[model samples]
Target: MQLLFGIPTNKYSSLIPTTFPENVSQLMKVFFCLHYSYKYNYFSISCWQSLPYNRPTFCELYEQINKIIEIMIYIIWNQMKKVILHWDKEIRDCERVMLELTIAQNNQRLELEK
Candidate 1:
């Protein structure tokens, strides 16, 4: 989880807390930061269940993590599409401007030759 998100820290300390309360409660508080997605929060909370049996099994965790990855990929793909389209339009506009400028320059040369 820390690999996906990051190590939790508070205003008081730059390192991980040594105590139990700080490890659990303080960690949860840090997870509330805007950078964490809802899926990450839910997965982290489920894994932290006090009872071992209550926590997700390895298979379950794998499936949940895959789902999160798929969702992220889908979002990123859509954003990339939008960015590509925007750049495509910008390039076309620049080309049109350049063509117009070239035509104006050619017409000026023709006038000068007359």
Candidate 2:
């Protein structure tokens, strides 16, 4: 399972390191643009679908909030990158865990769609 995270791996860390201000700003701009695009797309669709005149019921609202919390927690978790220098067995176990999670999510989504 490939991870989406921040810290560079140890061996070739300095290979991509940059100390330029312009490079930093460029990276920030790209990140913000991608962020805004995703945010605005979700908000625009959900906002129109959930107008107050035809607002969601209490249970629906509760479900929506729970979904938001789940997404936030997932994003927060992926932002953390812990460099673990462990045995091959431990790394394999972690990969298996991540694979199981991905499969579970896909199965759940399929069930919902059906």
Candidate 3:
């Protein structure tokens, strides 16, 4: 899953690092982009869809804001990249545990049937 402006989505909300960005202006920038993306294309990100905003006249404003601050996005992207890596590892570990549980359950069922 992916958020607006290409932020990858995680299965759990707690895994998302930038849910509450430190800077309010930057947060608004993100929100603006999200709104724009939601309007123009398919936005299936369940968590982000919950934001309360109606799109009317934010596209031009967002473009202006984005033009002034490309570097800020780079900084935020780097921070989110680290978090994403960590979450990926955690997700992999959880998947492994789930696979093991399924195998054990199957084995137990086989033994019971025998």
Candidate 4:
């Protein structure tokens, strides 16, 4: 979902969803900002704009943002590992198949040479 000029819509309404989340409504706001920015990125900056920077920084709010970042990093690492493992297994299977074909060819050549 997305919001434009204070309206709501789906991802198909315009562009691909990819934005920084600063609002309580995580997915919706992220989509809205991304879709809106894909066209008018030069305009409208951030939700934190015009607000006092007196708010806590990531280091200051380590208990919050840091934990979220840690979990996200872990998830991404595991996903990447799974993809690598899957591809590696495929490569091993291909190698085994090639070896079997080579052995069969060699046996056929030996019988023909007899």
Candidate 5:
């Protein structure tokens, strides 16, 4: 969980009690302040379950982690696409401006020749 978010310190350390709460109220306080993603909070809490059998098996944990990774990859890909698109637009605008300036310079040369 700390890996997903960060290592809790100082005030943040208080959020995670010495022991897991029997109910979610204690956990809710942490989530409210941290504003953690629901999936991350759910997975972390599930792993912290009091009963070993209640917690996810190694295979289940692997599957859940993979799903989270996939979602993160998708989000990053979309953001990169947006950045690339913005760069493309800026490059086209710059090319258009350069062409206009070149045309103006050519007209000035023609007038000088005349």
Candidate 6:
């Protein structure tokens, strides 16, 4: 998810879902900002624009950002180890539909070959 969100969206509204717990939401925002700047080459411009406010710019917030990233990684790793998981059935259903389509195509191919 972190890796994929860097791509430009067709519309600005195509953001990651914000339905997670508050802590997770905040962590995701920080992670997104970090990943976006790194992947898209916008760090300097982002930092400069944010300077007018007292907010910590990317460079200045390096250590704290890294700490947050580490915390997020630790939380996810622990959950994975415990087999704690959440499944989005909509995505699973989409996968099932694609698989059914592939099988149908293969069956059609076999019939035509016969």
Q: Which residue pairs show backbone clashes in model 4?
A: none
Candidate 3 lDDT tens digits, 12-79: 33223454556854544454455444532222223334332422235644664464357568778999
Which residue pairs come into collision in candidate 5? none
Query: Per-candidate TM vs. native?
Result: 0.64, 0.29, 0.40, 0.49, 0.67, 0.28
lDDT of every model, 2 decimals: 0.65, 0.50, 0.55, 0.52, 0.65, 0.55
Cα-based lDDT at residue 85, candidate 2: 32
Give the per-residue lDDT digits (tens) of candidate 6, residues 50-88: 224633455766865676668669878998766633445
What C-alpha lDDT, on a 0 to 100 scale, does residue 50 get in candidate 4? 31
lDDT of 5 at 37: 75
- Candidate 5 vs candidate 6: the TM-score winner is 5
In angstroms, what RMSD does candidate 1 have relative to the true structure?
8.7
Higher-ranked by TM-score: 2 or 6: 2
Compare the candidates by TM-score and give the number of the best one.
Answer: 5
Name the runs in model 3 displaced over 4 angstroms.
Answer: 1-68
Minimum summed lDDT over a 10-residue window in model 3 is located at 39-48
For model 3, what is the error of residue 110's alpha carbon versus the real structure, in angstroms, after optimal superposition? 0.9
Worst 10 residues of 5 by lDDT: 3-12
lDDT of 1 by residue, 1-114 (tens): 332233222113223335445566565455444255786676656665544576679998788767666866897999999999999999999999999999999999999999
> Whose TM-score is higher: candidate 4's or candidate 6's?
4
Candidate order by TM-score, decreasing, is 5, 1, 4, 3, 2, 6
Q: After superposition, how far is residue 91 of candidate 1 from its true place, in Å?
A: 0.3
Answer with 2 or 3, whichever has the higher TM-score: 3
What is the per-residue lDDT of model 4 for residues 5-105, given as tens digits with 9 covering 90 to 100? Answer: 22222222222235435454463343345442352232212222333263345554455445445656887999999999999999999999999999999
lDDT of 4: 0.52
| Residue 15, model 5, lDDT | 33
